[model samples]
Target: MIDPRRLRVLRALAEHGTVTAAARALYMSPSAASQQLAALEAEAGHALLERRGRTVRLTATGAVLAGHAARIAAQLEQAEADLAACSAGLAGEVTIAAFATAITEVVAPALPALRARAPEVRVRVKDAEGPASHRLLADGEVDVAVAVEHPGPLGVGDEQVLLHEPLYAEPFDVVLPQGHRLRADARVDLGALRDDPWITPWPGNPVHDVMVRACEEAGFRPRVACLSDDFRAVCALVAAGTGVSLVPRSALRGGLLGSASGGVVVRSVGGRRPTRRVFTAVRRGSQSHPLLRLALDGLRAQAASLAG
Candidate 1:
């Protein structure tokens, strides 16, 4: 009988054009690839490859086989995905890749409600910025993603919008160590901290880029004291007096504050505005998932409470 593994080998050889390259991609040695291809030919009872100079070319039979193999490969993948999605007893995982602020301020609150509704559903998180999350969604690596839009500059990519929540009307105040000298002021001016080292998110994310620009607009370059995309960690560091940070106003409202405290104060900067806009994204057709819809409904309800 023609084995699917052999058919896969045949497909790979056709796609890559050489046993050497195909073997490397398949993580097999060239000799192994050749052996497998020969075995496949024997099983199929036909010539699948032909010599063209030092290279090989697919015969007409090979082309016909490759076509069938492609369909077979797709069906196999889809079958596996469906089985995983359906077998878990309210369990199947729904992975979410989100930008820093949304996960910290928005999604964090709803996790408990999600688990309560479908205790079997395993929710996983990834750090994917707004534009990049679309690629992950398209590729099927993540089932949901919470992305951000920075007011006028963001393009929504090809992502389907699920929920949009205005978490903070403006960007957060720069958190200072508790009992820091500036806490006494009504709102410390950005000019004072211009020379201070700042704790901010890493690059390739919106928050990092926004804070950097917020500082430059304040007329002085900021010294980034620590870098991370984790919201809780950022707060912990600030509480530890590691360095100051810019945080969303919503940070003041959640468990994100934790027990960590350093008598941190918050203040505003001048020039470029500090607030950011955020959006929730999922695959264009993914709302069909029962849990995905429930999750979004819970999110919107909680957001309305927050907004009020």
Candidate 2:
């Protein structure tokens, strides 16, 4: 019989593309990882990897075995989850990954309720973006992931082994200097800022994509004056009268606005407003685990409260 541990090592190698990387990910030394793969090859009676210069590629048999390995790992995880569900008490740690704002607005607010209802269940939180959080969920590194969904058709590659539950839709508001001409208006038109310099989130961020798309829909491209990953810094830049920006409403809460440049003012965008849908994702079969279910419920409740 093939050892499940060896199968896991093989799968990790396939995913990470190198022995050293796989070893680091799995918390093993390179020599031990190589030995495990050798043992796996002996069990299968075939070579599983082809080494060429500095990189390693999986052999045909390795690819086939790795696919089976993935299914086996998922099945084992589901079996464990099923067993956990049969227990009388809900007591376990659930690790969740989410972005910065969601951590404050969604996850943190739900903690009090979670503690009250399930004192035995502990929650661990990690800050991660959409793609990174999804990857962590797929790898079973996190029990749940809070991610942002943008506007567009889902691609074939977007299919995941996780279950998704929609939480809430958060609107984006324009942030401007107090002295800016549009600050006096109750609702600012995005097109009105066509010629104004913009301070935008870095590329590859979901918020940045939303901002760019919203501007394009308004019949103009944003003239980016600066790029920042931190929304607080973006707010400060706006307060400094450097450039205008769009920020999610959730970020404006929790003293973030109070600490920002006093010269900053927020206004809603007129017409169709840009919004990001926040969703919670969990591993397919583990969603029913008592601890995970409790956490999910708390997250849903918090989101509903925010929406209300």
Candidate 3:
């Protein structure tokens, strides 16, 4: 019989791509993780890993087994949820991984109501961006993840193991330096900013991708003047006349940059509106648990409030 614990190690190995990374996620030493894999291979009477120097790749049999392990993990979560339903009312801890804006605008705002309604339920929030949050969810590190819509390791095909729920969609606003030529316009034309230096998030960030794609569609590429992932820093640079930028409506609500009274102007873009869609994702088969359900409902309520 396959040991479920060792199978989890194999699943981690497959998800993380390196023994060291897998061990770090599992809170195990590298040697212990390797030992677990070796034991798993012994149980299967097959080589489950192809060692290449310090790195390793899952063998065909190992990959197949890892897939089964994921399904089994989901089933186990379902069993736990079923058991919890029988015990009592909502009373458990739920950890959420979210980006900066969601934490401030959505998750944090919903907490008070959750506390009032179910005082026994606890929530822990972790700050993480989209791709990172998905990894945390897949590794079973977070019970829920608030993420922007983007291509991630946990794609639509993994819906059987995960639940994707759309929370809200907010348009990106054009942020311009004070006294800029385009500030007089109600809706800033993207093409008009082609000549202006751009302040954008560092490459590989979802917001960065949005800026690039929007600019390309606008008939020119953005000439980057500064790169920062922090909206506060981005707004600060824009206020200092470093360059113009794109910011989400949610970030604006967080007061990253003050308002028109501050040394910057925020306006919507012309043509097709570019938006960032935020959503909450949870592990499949566990969404029905009372604690998770309450959390999800609270998040939905907060998102609705933002929309209103």
Candidate 4:
């Protein structure tokens, strides 16, 4: 019979390109990972890996086996959850991956309640950005992902593998340097700033897409001046007279009236404002697991508290 442990190593290799990376994820040395793969190939009686010039590529057969390994891993997780459910109150560990503000504003706040509900349920947090959180959830590296909602990447087909639970929608606030033409306005008109140079997140980020689409709907494309993913840095750039940009309301620590002292003014948009929705994603069938369910409910409660 093919060994399940070796299959896990193969699946890790498929998820992470390099054997070194796969070995690191598995917490094994490179030489030991290679030996496991060699043993698996012998069991399968086929060449599963092709090695050339310090790189490794899976053979077609290896890819097929890796796919099976992924399914088997999910099944094992389900089995573990089932067995844990038989024992006691929430008692298993749940690892969640999320970006900065979500951790500070949502996940961290939810923890005290989760601990009160189930002291034995451990929740581990990993720092990950937008797509990386989802990727980690898909690869079985994380049990839950606090991710921003986006199209194309997590489409209908992913429903079979993931269950997305939207937590909140945060509206974008326009951040302008002091003394700009529209700084003193009660609500900034997006169309009036058509000629202004804009700071934006790099292309492909969810926030960047929202900024571009909001500008396009306002009738012109924003002329790009700088790119940064960190909202703090974006605000800093605006303070230095770099350019104006749309920042999510949650990223700013204080309220709109309180955030104007740093040489940058934050104002609401006049027309239809663009917003990004944040959600928690988990494996499809795993949400009902006792520990995971409690964690999800705690997050929802915390999100409601924030919205209030």
* TM-score per candidate: 0.57, 0.90, 0.95, 0.85
Error of 1 at 77 (Å): 16
Local distance difference test values of all predictions, in order: 0.68, 0.85, 0.87, 0.84
Q: How far in Å is the alpha carbon of 248 misplaced in model 1?
A: 1.8
State residue 113's C-alpha deviation in candidate 2, in Å. Answer: 1.0
On TM-score, the candidate that comes out on top is 3
Candidate 3: segments with Cα more than 4 A from true spot = 152-160, 259-261
Clashes of each: 10, 0, 0, 0
Ranking by lDDT: 3, 2, 4, 1
Q: How would you encode candidate 4's per-residue C-alpha lDDT over 91-168 as one tens digit per residue? A: 778999998778888899899989998898889999888787876786678999998877556531345456788899
RMSD, every candidate, angstroms: 8.5, 2.7, 1.9, 3.2
What count of clashes does model 2 give?
0
For 1-308, candidate 1 gives per-residue lDDT tens digits of: 98888776776676566888767757789899889888988989999899777778789998788767756655665565455557544556777777655666567777898889888777888877756675565434677766666433332223122234443344567788885667777666677787666889887667777777777777777888899777668877887777788886666665556666444565664444487666566544455456666666666655555452
Index of the highest-lDDT prediction: 3
Off by over 4 Å in 4: 135-141, 150-163, 253-262, 306-308
lDDT of 4: 0.84
Off by over 4 Å in 1: 1-94, 99-105, 111-132, 150-170, 236-242, 268-273, 287-291
Superposition TM-score, candidate 2 onto the true structure:
0.90
